[model samples]
Target: MSENVLHLENVTMQFGGVVAVNDVSMDVNEGEIVALIGPNGAGKTTVFNVITGVYAPTNGRVSLRGRVIAEDHPRGKMRKMYAAGHLGEYPRSVNNTPDRITRLNMARTFQNIRLFKSMTVFDNVLVAKHMHLKANFFSTALHLNAREERRMREETMELLRIVGLENECDEIATSLPYGQQRRLEIARALSTNPSMLLLDEPAAGMNPQETEDLSAFIREIKDRFGLTVLLIEHDMNLVMDISDRIYVLNFGALIAEGTPAEIQSNPDVITAYLGVAEE
Candidate 1:
């Protein structure tokens, strides 16, 4: 079996004449925290989109566990789905849908907080479990079976405990402190039982203390859940502290890849940020 859980081979994405990601190839090995860091508009998020099936690459292949997951679409399905008004129908191909990717054991949190303001913290996480629950939509809609509902509640509680938010499970999602909201987003993602967790700027807008706490929480969740985390972060302290390996991007291309220590010493990385000549 391949050690890598995710792989991108010679991937490229173009918007008009601008190449957002250019022939970038990378991999995330199982049980590792890989950080993608770069200056603004350096294609870090573009790479994330390609991995999560948000955008199809124009040039290359994306694989999961050695299986080809995405290829260039000869005919875009979104156009047809929109024209036919069947955009919510079942996905015809793996590459064309985000749910298909989530079902394949990949889950992601957005850069922005997308929690349901009116829903309780527990309910937010519970909603994510709908993807894994065996009960059909009709069963849920009609409340036909007590067994399914009971099982769903139990599983939801379990996920809440995993994220250390069990105590505040009944609080409205928006009422929680900023740091806890970040953790809730992660718990919500975990309800799907994903093998890989993609966190987009988990530490964004956090204060120093909050950031430190979040750093510890991330490490705890990775060990307890046995997750391979791929994070895009601008917090140098957090990235250098937690990531097992680091990949740097600049202007939509991979400019450096190395361990945190190695990256800190790389002349190009330093130059990219400092714009100073190396001695």
Candidate 2:
């Protein structure tokens, strides 16, 4: 019963001599909108990949709630190298596939929109429901799980309504306006029924008005679905307006973490973004 919805403990990712994430650790508590913000090459997305199991940590642990989902380390000669004089920051760790991690009350959307291009909007959302489908293979093959089908339909429609995408249900997923496609991606993620939602650059290509609407929509869904959201965003305005707490990264290391106001004032954060001035 830990209050933290997600925790990354001493996480590090090393490729040969380069450490993409250097002993980075952070927490997302229940019902909080937390953001990871950084300049390009700051390793923000690397942390997300570790959390979602896209890449196992070279060393460190990733946990959702209280269960350890992913852990990794150097292998064979790498192990021997580390043992001799090159120790991984933390220790050996475990790793989980993306799907397995998704089932543990967590789900995420990509930075780029990754919809099923040929599928209808409804089917894109409907496809996520397959994760929670209760019908067995035989029941599914025989179409005997009428109850499950009805439930899935009800769930999908409810999600579409929640995201204001009900009218687009029959449209081709790729044909929707850019903003709606973003909304649809979220709706699809929502269909997985995750308690926590991880959004990567949800405002990437949005205009000021769209970003404004998206910020509001995100907050609305957090309240409506009772979700704890951890987001990676470059839209400073949106990040500042919506985040309860913000974590800043520079060169694969956390430089600051605090409330939005505090993050704004941190000298290190300013330096990271604006760079050092000549003396």
Top of the candidates by TM-score: 2
lDDT of 1 by residue, 1-279 (tens): 338898887777766557677777889999999999999888888888988889976657789888778865224542432211112232323474778899999999988888989999989998887887777778878888678778888988987887789999999999999889999999999888898999999999999999999999989989988999999999999999999999998878888999999999999998887778758
Please give the RMSD to the true structure for each candidate, in Å. Answer: 6.4, 2.3
lDDT of each: 0.84, 0.89
How well does candidate 2 score on lDDT at residue 160?
Answer: 93
Pairs that collide in candidate 2 are: 70-94, 71-93, 71-94, 71-95
| TM-score per model over all chains | 0.89, 0.94
Give the residue spans of candidate 2 off by over 4 A. Answer: 80-92
For model 1 the TM-score comes to 0.89
Off by over 4 Å in 1: 73-94, 276-279
Tens digits of lDDT, candidate 2, 123-213: 9999999988888999998999999988898899988988998998999999999999999999999999899999999999999999999
